[model samples]
Target: MSRRIPLPPPPPPAEIQSWPDREARLVDRALAMDELGRRLLGGRRLTLFLVWFVLLELGWSFVGVALTAFDHGQIDPITLMLVMFSTCVGLAILVPAVWMTVRGILRDRVARERLAQWAALDSHPATDARLRAPTLGLCWLLLSFAMCAVGLWISFAVPAGTSREDGGYGFVAYGMGIGLILWITGLVGLTKAVGHYRFAVRLTGRPGPRSASSGHPRPE
Candidate 1:
């Protein structure tokens, strides 16, 4: 006589499994942490760049004051032209250079966040590929600025022919010529860099994974 065997307790229901739910909770928590990290990093990066920018501006102001003292009232037409030309070039280059650097830094931060997201997923590709353009632009701008600064210094050092000569034309001409060339080269590089960044943004989408989404489960 076989005793009536009690059926084994039925497997837990889907909702009771707890694993998926727990996983979802963990994912939510990780995402939150990732967002916080991004915000912190972004703020720090911007602060650093801002400080650098202020320093650059201060140096430029000092140089302008010195130039004014040296050439006050007795400006050479040729030197004036060079100064005007260099000023134009500097303005043109500076706007985009700062823009590209800031943009690149932001992209880099996004890439880092993507990396953190990938760690949880089944597959995660590196975002470094997206950085190529911005990085290139940054390098080009830095090089161009350095070259221009050097040219300006050299212009000041050239011998003056007479007391009437402020050496402005010679200084301005050589400095502006070198600066213009560098600015043109930087612009070309900046264009290429921007294209690369756009392509990367299209591929990965801006603010990926960590993007704002209420559907994302809340962390436990």
Candidate 2:
């Protein structure tokens, strides 16, 4: 006896006709969705990051001042304890600040690339102004200036021979040390912040939908 083999039929004509267009549309939708998601998510994160930065800076300044005050009296156990606590907090804040600064700077670069991609795709112009300007960079610049000023003032205020034993200098020597450190760090921060700002401005062109003077977004 002879055996017969059956061949499977091809897909319907309608299925073939619809597949390519459907797939293309799906891809487009996915890409658009992804861009939107990233924009929204990035904006929220950036805002939160800035707020945390401001709070930390304020806290650090206060702690530093308090430590300087303690240094004037005596290097007692309590003073030592407070100094240690302040140092620990400063170190802790510094770790996260540095991490966030680097992260934000990298994210800014990524955002520039994203803008390029959008332009290439002829997507809608992003109305979110946060992406256009280096907000964190500006904050860093302002903070750096303030820190440098404070450091200079402290340095000038510290007299020679201010020692803990005589309770005359209180924390003058320590103040000078901290002041110098702050000044150096402030200069470094300013340089990096300026670089970031310039790069961001170049990438985004004119500041998006917002005007820089008023710090508010225009009607989109």
Candidate 3:
């Protein structure tokens, strides 16, 4: 006992608590809740976009049918060919444009959600994914337009036979119809793939930075 000072009493458990640790736990919980809310809203937005897409397609189809019926008699071979080409080009552009717009909206929403999550947790993986639907959609649009151009070239270069028996304009019409159908099917598939990717990202909390890139979950 060589003049040892009396040991101080042990500190209370509460006194030993770390404020930073408590705050971090609170922040993590808040972030998880925020992410949940954001996902809920994202789901609603996705549903609305889908409904809008359906309505737009239905309206456009009805109008196209009406116009064709009204002008069927007045459309000559050249005019018919032009109409077919125009319709293809219009669809090629329209589908992508709509997809891009929808993607932009969804992207903004996701960004906002991510920001909120970041604010709470102060942690997020750096991401360069800007809504790329527009870019990819544009690429597809250009490809479809190019295909339509090729069809147009074929239509003009293929000589209209002197005799109606040679199937003059009918052959061109049939070819145009088939090409249009194929083009539309391709676009539809592309859009569906995009939608599937989006859903997967949302469901799995994966970051899809590009159209083809796969997102992986953060390890627990």
Per-residue CA lDDT of model 2 for 1-220, tens digit only, reads 1342221222233324343554453344335434532432344544544554564564465456555766455577886877787777776776676566566556545544443333232222343233334555566678778878987887777755455564444366556756775676566556645654453344346433321132321111
Which residue pairs overlap in candidate 3's backbone?
none
Q: For residues 1-220, write the lDDT of model 3, one tens digit per residue.
A: 1442222221123335343654564444344434433332344434444454444454344335434433345667776676676566556655764675466455544544443333223223222122223444344445545545654554454444323454444444544444454445345434533553464244335432211123222211
- Model 2, clash count? 4
Q: Which regions of candidate 2 are displaced past 4 Å?
A: 1-43, 62-67, 70-73, 123-220
Compute the lDDT for candidate 1: 0.42
Against the unseen true structure, what C-alpha lDDT does each candidate score? 0.42, 0.50, 0.42
TM-score of each: 0.29, 0.42, 0.31
Clashing pairs in 2: 71-170, 71-171, 72-170, 72-171
Q: Which candidate is the best by TM-score?
A: 2
Those runs of model 1 whose alpha carbons end farther than 4 Å from true positions after fitting are 1-19, 42-71, 97-220
Sort all candidates by TM-score, best to worst. Answer: 2, 3, 1
TM-score-best of 2 and 3: 2
lDDT for each residue of candidate 1 in 1-220, tens digit (9 for 90 to 100)? 2443321222233345443644564454345434433332334433444444543344343334335434556668776776666556555555655565566456544544443333323211243233334544455445545545554544454433323355454345444444444444344334433443454344343333432221222111
